[model samples]
Target: MSRIFKVAVIGGGIGRAHIAEGYSARPDLFEVVVLCDIDPVRLGNVGKQFGIARQVASFDEVLAMPDIDIIDICTPPSLHLEQCLAALAAGKHVVCEKPLVGSLAEVDRLIAAAHGAKGRLMPIFQYRFGNGLQKARHIIQQGLAGKPYLATIETAWNRDAAYYSVPWRGRFATELGGALLGHAIHAHDLLSYLMGPVASVFARTATLVNPIEVEDTATASLEMANGALASLSVTLGSARELSRLRLCFEHVTFQSALEPYAPANDPWHIIPNSKAAATAIDAALADWRFVPSRFAGLFAAMHTALVDGSELPVTLQDARNSLELVTALYHSAEQRLPVDLPLRPDHPAYGSWLPEPFRG
Candidate 1:
């Protein structure tokens, strides 16, 4: 086992969740050496609660600490790139939250920074580490389902007006984008993870459901690399909160719910075209056990990678693929035409995107 490395956590809202996960399970591998937030009160409160010795007002303060090994960014979407780049420049690894950086260009820049520093940068796509999702990945990998034919994702979660009342919650400039950017990112990442790279995308977004500055609902049609088709729907206007992913292949169909972060414990239906595949799937799942939290597991993997020079759980190219989907979605919505993958730097939506009325 390697020595416990020092870590500094940025932001305080959901960043606190990462801190809690870090301090709770992996004290032998990691120690929360510092906590930083723009809000001093929040910094103080989190520091006290987490038994942290150092609380600073800026991420730079945390970065300046010689002992810090990783900078865990739980900050808003808008600030991810800035903090991540700074951390890399200062010779620290980064664990940034989902939607990586706001735009494809920012994602590229962070990737470049990590390359130059020879440091690892991981995006928080925790859903991939969940037991339920992992089981789905296993099913796909083992070819029990044959080649996937279709994927349907439903991210129907409620986010009332009060939820967006906090600063930078629903705005394009800060929160980056809406449900697709914030809430459904995990589902989207999973879709890409399981199905492989999307060849093209067509999407439509609307703000009819919420009064926020960004769209609260969207529907996207995806064509995968292997000719599989996928339909993704994101809505913060759902009357009830539920998340589900259904994948149908030639041999079998698998479906699983949100599973409250413990995907293995969740009930998954694996219906088959024939009974033999069903028997195989049943035997496979019988040995399955739920992993507690996706974030925790991934963090543990990241720790191993940092300490043992192992593989990163989430890679820069993976982040690029996730950002590619977002880039395609925004472009397809803007041009009202299907946009292809491998977006170029010259793409109109590469840097920033805004709807007609909102575009300055």
Candidate 2:
């Protein structure tokens, strides 16, 4: 029997979903011992809904607790670096949300700190765990997909003024970025997850959707490391929401479902160029196991990783890859030029990707 891991979840917003779908799904693997939120109202509501008897209003209190084995930081983008580092310092495993930190430099710092810390850090990219996406990943891994070709990734979702009315959003200082960082990040991460690393990026971003400081629409051209090209289009103004990935490989083409939030779910349109290719794809997925969508699947994998000392499903480096792409996209848009990947310390935006006015 696997020993249940105790978790303390901070930030009652997305944190609640993590508790509901993740910890609740695997009662044998995890237990939500505490729920922490600065807002007492939110804390009480989420705590009561989840049946978590222990509730705390302060982060310091959560940190000081000795029984909590994992600290899940679902707080805002700005708080992630500090909160995650502190949790690691307290010898507690950490799971943080997207746009892990403000800058590439900060991500590097956390990467360095993680090396010496007692607890492991796992970044959230739950979209990568869906069954349809997993099968595509398996097919590619088995070399049934042959060489990579072109791919089109799209993230078009609605976000009105009310959504940005939250105090921290729609500004570079708080939200860190617009749709690219907050919404489409998961889709972009999926791009890297299956298609491999990006070699260069040429992007253009605009704020035409909402009357806010940050951009809501964007388009980017990418050169994958394996010599494949990809086009990324993102907009928060879509009337009909969609999150889709269509990958055209040398032997087959894989397309995700049009579901906005859970595009990785089944019904993916997978087309093989030949009978032999179709047979190979079938053989590859013959023994495919269930991969629960979103948080449930991610947490199960995390539990196994924690117990058996395996590599985390999503590591800080994966966060780095996501952020580096964001940085390059921002830089390219601002400079009106294509930017190369694997940004170094010497890059101007290495410290912070915010436009000049937004950087504090």
The C-alpha TM-scores of every prediction are: 0.92, 0.99
TM-score of 2: 0.99
| Cα RMSD, model 1 | 2.2
**Candidate 1: minimum summed lDDT over ten consecutive residues — where?**
258-267
Instruction: Indicate the TM-score of model 1.
Output: 0.92
List where candidate 2 sits over 4 angstroms from the true fold: none
- Any residue pairs clashing in model 1, and if so which? 132-263
User: Candidate 2's residue-wise lDDT over 45-80, tens digit each?
Assistant: 999998998999889999999999999999999999
Regions of candidate 1 where Cα sits further than 4 Å from its true position: 259-265, 282-290, 356-360
Top candidate, metric lDDT: 2
